[model samples]
Target: MNRTQFLRLCALGAALAVGGPAALAQTYPSKPIRLVVPWPAGGGADAVGRAVAEALRVQLGQSVVVDNIAGAGGNIGTQQFIRQPADGYTLLLATSSTNSANPYLYKRTGFDPVKDFTPVASLAVIPSVMIVAAGAPYKSPADIVQAAKATPGKLSYGSGGVGNSAHLAGELFKSIAGIDVIHVPYKGSSPALTDVMGGQLDYMLDTGAYGQLKGGKVRAVAVASATRHPLLPGVPTFEELGIKGMQMNAWYGLAAPAGTPAAIVERLNGAVQAAFQAGDLGKRLTDVGAELRPGTAASFAAFWNAELQRYAGLVKLTGATLD
Candidate 1:
């Protein structure tokens, strides 16, 4: 009603206009977010990504949508994320194929897993199960080694892709066993498992995506880890199967484009950690043959670096080329 009161009101309005948006942005996730899964729907990556997205949606109080943009061994969807705004609203579901192995696999990957993406937190690690067709002569990993020894270049195995984690796992198996098994590269694990099931291929050492044992199409002979998974309790580990230094597993993590605000990254990480705390999320992961693993951004960075180093060594050892 007075001039002074009007001036004070104007000043208060200016301050609110400047500071209101800043406070709201600090809250983050004011709306639904998009999570890109770099694999086709119905695949392990998609399944896991959706599960995590659902959990994050509930934890963050914002809808998390999963978009499958599969291609080029997961680089297509991943590249899309690199080009997206680094504001935590857009996320990429990271897998071993895209993050750790793909960089070394390609002559030039569009995005650097370590530098281009900021890891929120690791979701889980799924152990690879070495499965053979039911009718295959190799009843165990030793049997496969014996076959490889007897027929070096003749004995062959299939993998999802040339430089995929499964292919590298098979190569590691060969290196440790002192055997030479030809790798038959397929587009994805589904097809590789298809051929292996139809007896078109001898065996496949892949991440546990096929669910072969339950279908009775293939027999899981060994797991590519130090200890056998509870889901594959009957199957022997590589070491127990007479192969040493051949442990391998695939992991999943949540990441955003680099340069995302630190607060936003922390908020996303907190949501992921909250999802991990919720019991059903762990059970869901376990049902999908993954063990829940949650860690801070620093821990994820260290893990990513270690993985990169390990895969690089394997790439050199195998002389495997993707280009």
Candidate 2:
């Protein structure tokens, strides 16, 4: 009602408007954060999501809850995550399936991987292993290739799903080895791997087959890495086995909705670096056959961009699609 009162109110309003983001950054993660994994629970993505969330909980002094929203090859959950507030409270545990391959495989994924998210960190690279039942006749990659060539479509391989890294790896193997192996797509890797172990499926290229291999439930013939994985040192790489043009590694990363505050992104990146430095997370990831690849937000963004380009080429080469 008075000039002095009006002036004081305006000054307070100006201060709040100007200092809002800075103040928020200083007191960020004041409440619980949601870490969305665009895949089903109990899968590799969910495991990695929980691991990163736990580490961030200790570093950020806030609860980081993992929420799984699986469907449409990770497109459903990714679209939902992109629609959340860009306040950094909601983050996505992104994988190669959602970020690189899905965009090319699906006719419409409803969100741009590069434009709709802000990279936070690159977590790890998971190498896929060619595995068969413990009692299968195929003892090596060459044996499997020869059998497929001799029998044509008599031999079949299972994958987590169509357009997934496992499927693409199998396709790449078929192309390079010049063999005809029927492809069986399951809803998830667990089921596909189960079939492989049960002898219903001849073999599968899977990233999460380490436990089965170690438990003697399945035998690994070859790894899709340039070198042998330390956990599976006895197994050889595809290159070492004379299999060319078949190197593929699935990766996991953390990202926030686009336009998230740079300060929040930087803080999250720092938390990731600290998580890797703690040594426990790296060891746990390695135990599951994942190679830790901790890096900055900018570095992750660059890597993600390159992955997009690379997967685009692979998609074209394999003629894999999900319309």
Candidate 3:
């Protein structure tokens, strides 16, 4: 009779009309859920995916298994992911790169991020940091800019590869700062970071390199955020330093294949928010330099759209392309 009961009954009737496994949105996840992490094992995406799965498992009272389908810069796995049934049991560990940037960077992503997926909830954001050797001469963003201007093409930065977040950030910095620098692409971020630490490269902007920032291994000159991150409070943000349009963050989230039940999406998003509210999952993400992001499905969708637009401009600004 009450509004809550009426809504529940409506959802139940709709589920029954569909008449299948997806009809039970109220009691969904009767079995283990599959979380597809479109990245390699032992990587940042893998770690966050596993952590999210564990938290969801605890919150939903069902196991959440991880499946890594990494290749072709996270495009091959996504191509397969879109084929999954629009059931709540399957989810994608979505990232800014997979959902926002790849479409603009790659000629064929095989999946339409906007049309083929349903935004569930945003999990966390990993901001980029401009890092140099602990003993490097560049003390700040200004210092780096000065050196680049003086030496022109002599200053170089390394990245995981072309069209990667690091490369895009570096290019944005180059464009805004009006400096000439070389971009050295590597097979992976590890080797690129190694070159930075070994003095072979001048700087490297990255999200996954936070683990290497301790013990004076590297000096963080500036963070690509509107405000200072707790992990690096002493380091100023690019915005605060009078550099605009530098708030680059790699946001992670949970998304389901398009056409999934609205009740199911709401239920799963509740679990995501509850998992963060439980404190353990947020702490786990924070330990690795990720800022917690709690949002509804609607908000996540809006954020995704805005990010897609932003990435489109970024791709055009950098003239970055992948075959």
lDDT of 2 at 107: 75
Better of 1 and 2 by TM-score: 2
Q: How accurate is candidate 3 locally (lDDT)?
A: 0.85
The clash tally of candidate 1 reads 0
Give per-model TM-scores.
Answer: 0.88, 0.92, 0.85
Order of the predicted models by lDDT, top scorer first: 2, 3, 1
Model 2 TM = 0.92
Best model per lDDT: 2
Candidate 1 residue-wise lDDT at 292: 84
Greater lDDT among 2 and 3 belongs to 2
Worst 10 residues of 3 by lDDT: 18-27
Give candidate 2's error at residue 190 in angstroms: 1.3
Which is the better candidate, 1 or 3, if ranked by lDDT?
3
lDDT values, one for every candidate: 0.81, 0.87, 0.85
State how far residue 258 of model 1 sits from its true place (Å): 0.5
Q: Clash totals for all models, in order?
A: 0, 0, 0
lDDT string, candidate 1, 115-234, tens digits? 898988889988888888888888888888878798878877887776777788888787778887778877667787888888887787777554567778888888887788888888
Per-residue CA lDDT of candidate 2, range 1-323, in tens? 79998997687567558887665566677789999988777667777888899989988999999998878777888999999999899999989987999888877899987889999999999998999999999999899988887889999998777777888888888888888888987766778888899999999888888877889999999999889899888899999988887798789999999999987998889888998999877877887789999889999999999999999999888776662
